[model samples]
Target: MGDAVGRRPAFLLSVVVIAVFGLLSAVANNYGTLLAIRVVVGMGIGGLTIPFDTMAEYLPQTQRGTALLSLSYFWTFGILLVVLSAYVAQQNFRLLLVLCAIPCILSTLVAAWFVPESPRWLLAKGRSAQALDTLRRAAHVNGHPDAVSLFPLGMKLKAEEPEVKSFAVICSPQWGKLFFFLSIVWAGFGLLYYATIMLVTDIFAQDPAERGEADGEGVDIDYEAITMSVVSEFVGLTVVMFTIDRFGRVASQVFTYFSGGICVLLLCLFASADSTSRNLLVVLAFGSRLFMSTGSCVTWTHTAEVLTTEIRTTGHSFVNSMARVTGVISPFIVQGGLPYRTIGVILFIASILTTIASFCLPETRGIALGTAMSQDSTTAKERTGTPNSQEMSQSPATVSDKEVV
Candidate 1:
């Protein structure tokens, strides 16, 4: 687990990625330009998430869930902004895109100006004096007790003992396990979630040859579709927020994943018929979005909490990046937005990935950040020690003194 100290970089990284995506979107020209920009954008976004998971391990256990939930509210507000724009700002989507970028860039600047470095990272690096100062700042902000209890650990005294590895190390020995699993799971999550939400438009487009037969209002505006988007995007998130607190993390996530899969299969099976299929697809789409959002939101909460504090930003960045990468591809695949039977197949595939990944992850509803990192079993952990013990022992705490050799 990490302390408030460990959470700093991840937050700062998130701010940077958000701004970068804005720049990419602003500059993108063609489909290919947008695609390449998205990949780079995804990686930068991915880099930002490391701190959330890591910070969970650092705080007092009772508050971890609450803190994460509050963090989620920030994300939800971003989504809410999108929903509002889509509903009210009909003609200026491009401007909306640019506006999103502005905040991200501003966020990065604010982080640099105001936010302090993570005390945990300092301790892990063996910068005791610096870490202690950070610790005081954390307590002052949160009104927590002055935690002199920070472990005796420090970064290696020599500094050269455990040099941070390069990307090749992330790939070779680690095989980027964190990155890979997160990518796969996020692929499913993104595809499933977005597909469920957008399937209405897909239905309209797919059956457009029969547009004369598409609507009830006789005007063809497809109000059911517009209404569904609103209900699912804005109203549903607000509704789920309260339930999230009641249901907790694991239960809410799995329930959403399993139910979302069922919703998709139901839509495909029922919508196979012609006449009644359209409206039914709308209803099913709503259901899927609600359930899928429930799962997706919960997963975000879980993932951000489950990783070790030390590597939280790295781990979060990887997963989040994967989600964006998939989002970029999902549209093309689900509707042959490419040349394939993307929708049904992609949904099932996503279902399986989330099911498998969800099972593999450790449950961390109430765990502290410090404990989480000490117990981490990733490449760094086997090389160092468990996350909990490490937090207690002193991390990036002592390089020369605790060198593995």
Candidate 2:
């Protein structure tokens, strides 16, 4: 929908769907009705990627990595809030659902009123007049009214050829190899991420006798441990935010996946040891959560940057859907009566594979967004340079007039 109609419309539609279905879910009186409503809510949630695509297109290359990575902080904070809500609502699921719906409702208003369509998307569709108008409006709002002069009044982008379906283009030779490696990276991240959570939860939920603890003593410890793990996510985001643009996306992901896998293996070993101290187990679990959180943030940033703008959202959504599939498969492995060590071994191997896949992806650290599918054949080295250097090297007034049109 974003690729066809426009990003703002698709984003607005998504938030509206979530807000409406989320409220309905709170009032659902039957199990089947709630399940149906929640499924619709999931559909809405899937379209949230449109906003990320919009953000990437609007920002300049220099600030793009930091800006995108900063968005992950909201995810960490949202999780913390959900943890609090779960604690407060306890058995009042309806209240919890209402709390969850509030953010979507707020986001809907913001999207409808504040968000504008991407000028790049407008230009890609050969809507040059509208794209110029959008840019002018943005410059006026940013207190740079004269900046609009950088583009000529009669400037026009060459009309793109009759549109091809994004799926067909992504599956073609140009994008296929990049897409395949990205799918593996995303899927491995998803599986390992959820598997870590399940493993930690399982350990805390063990019977008191099995845990070598007094019957009533585990509850407080469980809450404290969970809180620490959640806090570790913030630490992880901080680490990645500082390193993503500096170290580049590929390096960041490679380090996080490999180190995170080791943490997972150590966590499993300590968890299964009867003589291991609880403090040691908690520390290892925190380390695992921290590394996984870092990997997740970098993966999202890298994928958004690497794909060309022509099929950016479609390609991103496809790879993310692969992640969702692995996310679904994670629970069965964690809870399907596999030995703890065995589950850990499987996740470690998956992470190692993902790390290898990360190495195969092109570095997109400082390149301008590729505006055409044909640009995919260019080597990463050829594309890599100071951020926005090609355009910024030109005088502002002549930049878009010469290159963009």
| True lDDT of residue 150, candidate 2 | 54
Per-residue lDDT tens digits for candidate 2, residues 275-315, read 88978888988989899888988888878777666687778
Determine the backbone clash count of candidate 1.
Answer: 53
TM-score between candidate 2 and the true structure? 0.86
Q: Report the lDDT of model 2 for residue 21.
A: 100
Residue 341 shift from truth in candidate 2, angstroms = 1.3
Q: Say which candidate scores most in TM-score.
A: 2
Alpha-carbon lDDT, every model: 0.57, 0.77
